[model samples]
Target: MKFAATVRAAALCTAVALLPATTAGYAQVEARVSPEFARLFATYQRIKTSYVDQVDDEALIRGAIDGMLASLDPHSSYLDGTALQRLNTMIDGNYQGLGISVQMEDGAVKVISPFRGSPAEQAGVAAGDYITHIDGRLIYGLEIDQAVEQMRGPAGSAIELTIFRPGRDNSFDVTVTRGVIELEPVTSELIDGNIGHIMVNEFSADVGSDVRNALRDLQGQATGRLTGLVLDLRRNPGGSLDEAVALSDLFLSDGQIVSQRGRNRQDTIVYESETVYRGDVAEGLPIIVLIDEGSASASEIVAGALQDHHRALVMGERSFGKGSVQTLLPLTRDSALKLTTARYYTPSGRSVQEGGIEPDIRVPQLSDPDAERRQRLAMRESDLRGHLVNEAGVQDEALERDRLDDPRFQLTAAQLEEQGVTDFQLDYAVRTLRRTAGTVASR
Candidate 1:
């Protein structure tokens, strides 16, 4: 039907205008109708005429579009009118809902971890719990976003979830009423040895301010400056791009912070650190970034920029490879397409596409053996496959050989699979930073 072609054409223009410009360089000049989209379009047209029941053309178009977008990025998926608004509100980090974080891993919607003091956490949701059904419907093969949508309801409304936790054989159910999630992204802790820990759960619009405020509060409470900063990016499935850039620039002075490139347009868009500087004086202090498989998108942006610039040392396994930038292109009735615009690179021009930013010292999580890749071969056809963004062109080089073995360190990348205990790794980072501080003091 011409209507299908008409919808695609009109939606394409609307999508382009609503999309984000990735990382300053190249704006998306056009949206390609992915092969999957094209094939689905044809199928929808056929379904209209051959269906046993009278099929609505608009319904067919929306269904085809939804399925097509869902195939690209697991995060980028279909949200009908009300659903789209709800998704946007959650991303804004001020949603009214049963607060919980879940991920699509290995074909199940598993709980990553609950936000501290959140409704879900209060209701007894724990990590490693699998959500088998929402309400009464089985959500086994649905996309991650679909399952998430099932969990969302009006603020006071209650929803029941049947969960399968690792230690429990029988599926247990929890019915929790929704509430508002208005907490700021930056939260802190006084962890072992006067360590100032800042957990940046997500990079929202207010994150930069929240971080600056958190650091101030922590510094004031301590007798002297805190020993070190553990910038936890673990399970922080990224948020805003601007927040990532702002957070990276919060520590770096004059380094080329991060760059964006796609379609071979090199000089098209580059983002140097804005006028921000580490005027706080504790900027270069011993900083350890904790990353894991869930740290992705803008999360990878901050980690990659900080690690490559040597502004902060990364101390976990490779981050989740989700560096490509996607912007929301709105369409009729709150429907929009989250299209991939460009891939982000570090200041050194290294792209964190398929293979994410590897930690300076690999500290795979000791808590989960199945999570660690003992001989983890890195990459697949769809995943970005390399570690370096501008390996051939960068001026500074990281020369330290991989320390797969070290007596003092118990959780190097290779050992995480064999044993569990990231304590040694954390201890080494602290000791190294403390030693560095002493050296600086002596000088």
Candidate 2:
């Protein structure tokens, strides 16, 4: 009862805060509490008193909050204490677990993508694999947070996972040993022909600075001056927005990077280049940005900025369309609302809500044998239920434009492997850079 009263009071406060200062606004706010509050309270009371089992007040309240957020969008949700801690752990980039991002789809936990060089990846947990159980216990209907909690443990711990991979005949189990996951956001190396390959794992803290350092290190390692650079953003689910801006600024000297517009005009903000960093760190070097269906949010932001500014040539398949920005609004110390506040835009004012960023050069991951199958089944923002509609009304045909196979990408995974090409996308980018070294830099 105490918690219910607290919830009511919080709702009232939120309503009052959203209302204008006029008396008419106050009347409208008061009127909003009439039938809606009664219906919600009635349902809560019914569930608490007449349910088959004794339902606690916290459970009822949390369920209500979760249901409310579920109605908004897939990204907007309530973060409980455990969820908050997990988010913090991701931001800190150090955790002991199977480093894979998973989402609940139709009561089944589906793997998004395993982090690079994580135990899950080392143990061969591919994306689109549905985790059916944890340690022999069925977890088909468990909450995503609960399922993730069951997976996390101290370093050197082992956990068994039952995976149901799509396109496979039967389910299989794999044992992954947990270790300390130190996420190195920016990792660079000098490839053949003095080309710098920098793979940004995520847009975590100090990503810009880390990238600058990586570029310097790459330049130092290169036999001669660096001819070109490939910024690989494949399978990066995005992180800090500020870091995205900073990373984009490293390649652009002038012009707007990205803009975000919300319901209120006051919430509109524009980010520009040369604000975070002075000038293009890798100035006059051909830059190719590689993106795929796994790249979303901050990754899209950086890709969009560089593409719009003609600083980098965006290659690979279309990106994961996630243009909305989620703002964390704290209600309590351990609880918060991750609300979708604004829809971001590229410098050219293109919103990648439903229609993601189309690559300048469409390159498929030919090294992955299941690339075509996964592309057909990949879920983006538009696939989610209750996702916000794009204002520009993106055509459905644009989403399927890549389905038609190109003659250039005819090589099979086995063929690529036989040719000693592990990553087809990166190799293609490297070859492109080698051939067109001064071309993208002149863009």
Candidate 3:
């Protein structure tokens, strides 16, 4: 139950290239608040009535709406009517706008990374690019959220963005046409001769079955005992917790997978791997998990649980460390609150918040080859920890080391960048499975 488990996992569940999905429960509950919502409603009334000069009714009501949604949780929140429509478009995975996921950094609007193959990337927008102008209106002082509101608009429209590319002084304008960007979840195919690779961009609804079907399809084609299974979770923003647990059960058996602890005494919950794991026919099959900073939430749960239980070999840099669970608490109207409800722990009782789980053998992905790029990166050995999500306490520190420079873990992101094949991480995983060929005795 990491902070971004739902949002992050939602990104990975994007297996739409392999699957499709949303978040909503308790359909019986109406979109209207009860009289019992006194604390919030009363505050709204008081603000509207007592505030200085006559307030704009619309603004006051919107403020009240925002407040109601904010109180629920971080993921759940009130989207104004117009905002709601845009959200629909965003989730639909297609929209006319700059294809970039942004965040507020240092009080300025900064681009996290341009979506691959999008207009932005075609325009050469990199991961850490910053926007200094929006159609010539200086954006240096705008907040990231406010800047995002300015960047989106009708389909087929075009926007000129002045980007402050890192390491360069002269800003440049890249005119990008707004187009529909489809986020892919799962991409599978045969590689390295008969080895079926499932690059799960993220986990989403029903991915459990999709994964099973994918495995079955690949196994149907392969002659050998599925020589290797490489699960590429690099940059995979994890999704649903249930999906994470279900996915874990696909490979694990008879052990604690993950657990959660809330502030209150009654809120603790533990998720355990089932005794019967997918008919047990795939028993002893090797699983190699690939992870990175973008691989978080449900992704961490899967990797951590497998690694902790000695079920799989986790390869990659330390994970994104997003172990706080945010539950979307629905409110009246079409809004909801994504509140951080619980903190999760690995099978060994380690929290992944602040400090993410340390991989048994660390392999870092270098997206750049230039020496300049290396200076910006730092995978400190001090950053390693046993925490799975947010739950604290030692469990299995001696089991593995966050060995970034270990000889056992080869084919890092930097090497992949040099060879021009980002799949080197998975390649390493496949190689490991090939080396450790045979049934894995259940511990």
**Best by the lDDT measure:** 2
Model 3 CA deviation exceeding 4 Å by range: 1-78, 82-101, 109-145, 153-177, 275-281, 370-422, 439-443
- Evaluate model 2: give its TM-score: 0.91
> Which wins on TM-score, candidate 2 or candidate 3?
2
Q: How many residue pairs clash in each candidate?
A: 9, 0, 39
Ranking by lDDT: 2, 1, 3
Better structure of 1 and 3 per lDDT: 1
| Model 1: lowest-lDDT 10 consecutive positions | 1-10
> Residues 137-202, candidate 1, lDDT per residue (tens digit)?
899978766788788777888888898865444788998888888856788876555567788887
C-alpha lDDT values of all predictions? 0.63, 0.84, 0.61
Rank by TM-score (best first): 2, 1, 3
Q: Give the range where candidate 3 is weakest over 10 consecutive residues by summed lDDT.
A: 19-28
Best by TM-score: 2
